[model samples]
Target: MTERELIKKAQAGHNSALNQLLLDNYSILKGYLIKLTLQKELAEDLTQETLLKAVTKIQDYEPRGKFSTWLIVIGKNLYFDYLRKNKNLRNYEEYDSVEKNRVGNQEASAEDHVISGLTFEKMRETLGTLSREKRSVFILKHYYGYSYKEIAEIEQCPIGTIRSRLHNSIEDIRRVMEEEGLDGF
Candidate 1:
């Protein structure tokens, strides 16, 4: 069924349609949260909160934007709210979450595992340096390929603010890479 049809059914209280819509967007939401939080467990927890909010508020959903975008805005708000309430997690020092998911598949060579692990480390390090707002804008725009207008809508900020945040985020990542002499990445 088309997205609109699914949404119509979902909004009308069709459990299957609601499940389908949430399932379809689960990975997108989780993947974005992983990058944003750099903590697998916290991302998973926030994703659950986001989906729950979506389900309870499904009736309030409008078709003005993609459903996935709406889910992200909810996810982002929950994340920020979580941050405000939990000061310690905001430090981004929670390696326990990443370590749990670091195990290689049984078939992968040790060499492949090592290379990928290093890449993940660098990425997490780079992304961890930015403020949450800039990180959200950067991830939505460059990582998720959303237009600035869509990002503004998802973030409920002015387009100019989104542009500025993205610009600063890119610069922040660039500065970190150069300063660390990790330029080749």
Candidate 2:
């Protein structure tokens, strides 16, 4: 069935339609969550939570955008809320072994090695300085390559707001890089 048909059936309280929708979109939602949270278990849990939220709120859905986009927005909000609640939690600083091993690979040229190190470190520091909303917008736009319209729909804001947020984020990063003489990156 088409998404519109599925949505119509699901809204009418058809359990099978809802289940089919979730099953069809689960992997896409999970992959998106993984990128946002950078953890497998957290991503999986958030995916489930997103699906549940979507099911419960299915009646509110107006088919304004693709169901996948709607699902991702719900997942993103849940992840942000989780971060806000756990803001005071202790920091865990273990480096990912995969990244470390990749950095140590003999195939890396001198220029490639230096550029990668600097880019990664600068990105980490820059990301830490952005407000939650700005960072989320930037990541969704640039890192995830989502369009402004899609982001606005997901964020429940005007398209201009997403554009402004992305502009400010890029300007901030540029200023930081210039100040630190890291513009070569």
Candidate 3:
């Protein structure tokens, strides 16, 4: 069945259809939450909360945007709420542990893994310097390949504001990279 059909059924109180809908969009939503939160465990928690919200609020979902995008919006709002309530603190130790535990490419040599890990760490550190709102714009646009219009809609801001935030985010990252002698910006 098409996504529209599934959504219709989900909205009509079909548990199977709702489960399928969540399953279909789970990876996209989780990946987005990971990028936004930079903490795998917290992202997982937020992903679960977002899915629960979807299950409870399926009837309110509109069909104008992709279901994945709707899930992202819900997840994003939950993350921001979490930040506000928790005073915007992130557990970097948890992120580092997660990164270290990630499996390296089997085809690549150990040196490649080390270099890639260093580069990723540098980039992540740079991203950490950005404000949550700016970081979200950057991650949504660059990491998730969201368009400015889509980001604006998800961010609930004007397109110009989204553009400005993205510009500033890029400049900040570029400046940090240059300062740290990192190339390939």
Candidate 4:
């Protein structure tokens, strides 16, 4: 069945249709959360929360946008709420131990391995430095390939605000890279 048909069924109290809808978009939603949160376990937690919200609030979903986009909007809001209620404090990351181990030196590696590892870490750090709102705009636009209008709608903000946030976030990342002498500079 088409997505519209599935959505219609889901809205009409077909539990399986709604389950299939959430299952279909689960990976993309989780991946987006991982990229946005920078903390894998937190991403996992938020994914569950997002899914629960989707299940409970399926009736509010409109068909004008992709279901995945709506899921992303919910995920973003939950993350922001978490940050606010927690007073912007994040505890020690259990995922970082794995990340550190992955970046460990390998005897057979060449320049590519070192460059890529450092680049990835630096990029992650730069993004982590952004405010949640700025990071949301950046992730929606660049990471997820969302159009300005779509991001505006998902973020429930003006299109101009979306554009400005994306621009500022990019500028911040660029400045960080330049300061760190990245990109062969």
* TM-score per model over all chains: 0.80, 0.63, 0.79, 0.78
lDDT of 3 by residue, 8-46 (tens): 999998999999999999998998888788889999999
> Model 3, 176: alpha-carbon shift in Å?
0.9
Local accuracy of candidate 1 as per-residue lDDT tens digits, 9-38? 999989999999999999999999999888
The predictions' CA RMSDs to the true structure, in order, are: 10.7, 11.1, 10.2, 10.7
Query: Candidate 3: which stretches are off by over 4 Å?
Result: 89-118
lDDT of 2 by residue, 1-185 (tens): 99889999999999999898888878778977765565689889999899999999999988877888889889988987787688732232211111111122232243233334347657757765665556666666655567778887787676666666666556577667667877364
Highest TM-score: give the candidate number.
1
23 Cα displacement, candidate 3 (Å):
1.0
Q: Which of candidates 1 and 2 is the stronger one according to TM-score?
A: 1
Total clashes, candidate 1? 0
Which of candidates 1 and 3 is the stronger one according to TM-score?
Answer: 1
The weakest ten consecutive residues by lDDT in model 2 span: 94-103
| Global lDDT of model 4 | 0.74
Candidate rank order under TM-score = 1, 3, 4, 2
Question: How does candidate 1 score on lDDT?
Answer: 0.77
Q: After superposition, how far is residue 74 of candidate 1 from its true place, in Å?
A: 0.7
